[model samples]
Target chain A: MARSQSQTVSLADVADAAGVSAQTVSRVVRGSDSVRPETRDKVRAAMDDLGYRPSFAGRSLKAGRYSSIGLVMLNITDTGNMLRLEGITSAAAAEDHAITLMEMAPGETLSLTEASRRMSALPVDGMIFNLNRMVPDFREFKPLPGLDTVIITMLEHPTCSTVDNDQMGCSEMIVSHLLEHGHANVHFISGPELSISGAQREEGYYEALASRGIPAPEVLRGDWTADSGYEAGARLAADPTCTAIYASNDAMAYGVAVAMHDAGKRIPEDVSLVGVDDSLGLFVPHNGLTTVRFDNRQVGLWAFRKVTGTHDMPRGRQHVLIPGTLVKRGTVAAPPSR
Target chain B: MARSQSQTVSLADVADAAGVSAQTVSRVVRGSDSVRPETRDKVRAAMDDLGYRPSFAGRSLKAGRYSSIGLVMLNITDTGNMLRLEGITSAAAAEDHAITLMEMAPGETLSLTEASRRMSALPVDGMIFNLNRMVPDFREFKPLPGLDTVIITMLEHPTCSTVDNDQMGCSEMIVSHLLEHGHANVHFISGPELSISGAQREEGYYEALASRGIPAPEVLRGDWTADSGYEAGARLAADPTCTAIYASNDAMAYGVAVAMHDAGKRIPEDVSLVGVDDSLGLFVPHNGLTTVRFDNRQVGLWAFRKVTGTHDMPRGRQHVLIPGTLVKRGTVAAPPSR
Candidate 1:
């Protein structure tokens, strides 16, 4: 099948067919509102007759702007990633700009050379990198000479702007809340050690305990999956002193809850659970599992704004950290008497 | 900031600077591996010195093909939508094609005219419309002259190819399972009335009941939310005769589970519950809510293939329906004796 018969058709050909100037044909092709309805109809009919198709590439070459943003994400399947994309898309739509999305293969780390290659090929005015994996050092990560770039990561870059949630603060808040509830100590279920956010949260957990003169206990590691959380919870459930548990994410916390239930330990009455990310609120509803909520969408929005130079803040490598709110629910309670 | 200094650099200029022919410059720009290492370095240095950046748009115009696909989604926030996007992106990346994403504003429907406009402006050879709402008449929905298009919906368009899960079959399987479990009649918590998938599922529910010579009971409406399912579950809980419930989606099914718990009804004992879309499996592991699972990712991958004309099928409008599998977890059981 013929994909496009208009490959050879030019603006001059359309203009000649429509009995108009090339500029008039160009205006019609660009969907300019200034063209008269009758004139536009005549030009469209001429285009159809000549098999002329307008191309966004031609328009971009002429206007020097693509009116679109490129988004580099590790994956869109994660709940946090989806919410961030929603925010970015909403902002782009409001600005009348389109979004070009690119996802890295699972377990793929984006290198500086690959990033530069993608930026050069992408027909976008700016790009937002939402990859959670470790990024190339900002000093060495030079984007295409002219493309504006922003990264969503826990670490601040010296050149590229950054946006992230306050991961450390979220953990500190969870630990303090558990401590304030009079628990002797809060056992931790940490996320993967390689994750930047996970490392920050773990640091905060230790810092919060240190500030209160409580020695840190052993940390159970989880790969941010519910099953991993379940395994960790089983170990915690076997220890009577583990009355309070903190999982790095909501999925893991739900797993811990299930493990506790299977062990015949009632929530709050026997054990208190808290997690980061209030993602399970939709499924669990009124059964509150105390957790920290981050507006990842806001992070996305700010990243877009920074990349596009649309934000009110001073330009040049700005770092914006969105704070997480601690949601108190039914999970935390005073420790049971020994 | 100056966006692109290479706007004025031409291929001829780069060739002159590199002391090579225009063809050689073009070959280097395309990242062809045929050039000698020393020659490639010379060309690269020339390109950098002349501020010559390779543009995908320029390459597309020259090759008469855009190595990109346009994905039009209603929203990416939904769990199903995100999964479909993951599948599409994975397929696209594997094929070395970029994805340009466009999202419709909430409450906004895509009219044929609007669709035609988007198709014209998009620099993509093909487009996949992942909108769940009602579409225009297939006869009137003409895409830009030769641009390939695919729609993901319950209904089929004579002109545009389509890929969808068997929504009706999913519901039928749910009803059949409940009936086989010895329930008198199944009560349905349906999705929004205007949703195409919702309508098809509801029809299947009725058809399955009719086939079994069982009259359809009162239908409880839900907007595909857990809260709406909770409301419906409360009404069903008040009537002890209503022992079996089928929620159109898993979110509502989870809500129903919560309501049953509140009412002190043991799952599969006091009430047998089934839901479509095993989405809650991530959060509520092992506590089986017997649900139907559709491979939405497969639907998305097939839709991408159809739109790009890459699938090994006939070169006309074709419909592909992915089947759903009934996963009997822990929620279904024999109805109690009246």
Candidate 2:
């Protein structure tokens, strides 16, 4: 049978694209770290472009332990939780770690406590804990005690082995993306005003717009759903001068997209849009959603490795402040006439 | 500080509904084997009506090791895989066993192989092996040496501790539901026909119609996607007699709903609908899917318990079969002009 075009993009093509010899591409693709950055970037870029995604099993066999790690998104009720989880799973899978997921009843208080106890009773040595929705103030300190746990989400449980979006950093990135598109005015549609995610990301947005000497356009509220996003979009769409809007997550961004779509305003033409956590399932790539891609899968893998012996993290408070990369998929274009 | 509503529905409600004392309701709820038939039915009816669901975690601590047996589903893409997985997960969780999930890349054959190897390596004694998208010819079996592996799908891996759904049972259930609602002419939307889920469920639809001496409904193919269901629904909706449709999975049913919604028809009032697997997160539960709720979690827990226990199976060929319960919700009603 003929191989998929994605699967058939060969080692030779990857090597050629990386400007390295074929065997060298093979070594790098095999995940050998000795390759020079110039070469590594070439190979990685080539692999990413051609979608030369290595098989997890092949990688597992070669690496002894699969480059794949496990990620259990603590709950599902929170849309942000799923988005961040999507980030973790897709990023980790892209980085060649097969992500293993388990959804807990987010509302159940003791579920996580019990899940941690049971996780210790099972295999899969390392795991990134996506305690997204059920962030208990005192609960974080319990420390799935014996297990190596890396916490994701800003609501730091009592313990500190965690990785969170540079809330401030992300807001800055979106604002900067808007600024690059020549929009002096950029508004932030923050998540539920009470949430830690809302506060941190909002702070970043305010700082970014303020530092640039451009008045922050306006503060609008959203609850992280597409509906809330539509409301935010409707508000912004009503404004004659509003040019760029950054939603807290993709659902909101989708709502914004729908609202924009309804208003007959072409994206990046009438107004620019930016969303956090490149969520895969809900919105289509066909929508051309300009998003800040957080490598959640990588975050998950990195956290898992930290918990297990694969990746070393020095003791004391440590974190992986994974930066959000702006995905310029044609959503951000020049703003309309001022 | 109050317990969650799902966890704390009382014996009083059960008693009130059954028109009996709370003590009698409590005894019946406990599944005491010696209850009077009339009293038991009254109590059972009351429990079901009041949503007086059982609490597995509270009582099953008496069972020794792994009272909470998790069925780790390595595959996550296919709706069938998820349904069977949900069946096992729901069953196990209901039976007081925890369900640990693991979703692997279907694209990575090696990862899948490695995942099976690792799943076998896990401490879980028994499990429902749902071959989501992978079809097997029962070739060289990867010996899952010790684990009581319940091969759920038709993919013949080396099997014991297996549970094949009563496909005919499900089909009869749906056909009966449609017939009860006065629809003699029903149409079918099946899953990937090569897979067991599609075949079994579709078979159920066919057998019921045939057994009733009615002509078999015209069948359409769907890959279990809302879009495919949309395509199928659009085609079906155009027909004036497309008064009844059976989608193979809840996702496809959702698609059918959207297509019907777009086609300007009320569900059940215009076209009575039935689907399999009351899937979670595919869409909001506004359309309350009338599906074959295969209590997968119980299956997972039971399978896990069976595998991990001292239960003796006569070495050669063995498997377990769990029944799928008919979950009648808002999807199906009498066909138009009935």
Candidate of highest TM-score: 1
Model 1: DockQ against the native? Answer: 0.45
User: What are the TM-scores, per candidate, against the unseen true structure?
Assistant: 0.90, 0.57
Error of 1 at B7 (Å): 6.7
Clashes of 1: 0
Residue by residue across A237-316, what tens digits does model 1's lDDT show? Answer: 99999989989998899889888877889888899899899887453536678889999989988888888877575777
Model 2 share of native interface contacts = 0.05
Grade the docking of candidate 1. acceptable
Regions of model 1 farther than 4 Å from truth = A1-10, A28-53, A107-109, A135-139, A282-287, B1-10, B31-41, B44-52, B107-109, B135-139, B282-287, B336-338
Q: For candidate 1, what is the TM-score?
A: 0.90
Q: What is the lDDT of candidate 1?
A: 0.83
Instruction: Report the number of the highest-DockQ candidate.
Output: 1
Model 2 alpha-carbon miss at residue A106, Å: 5.9
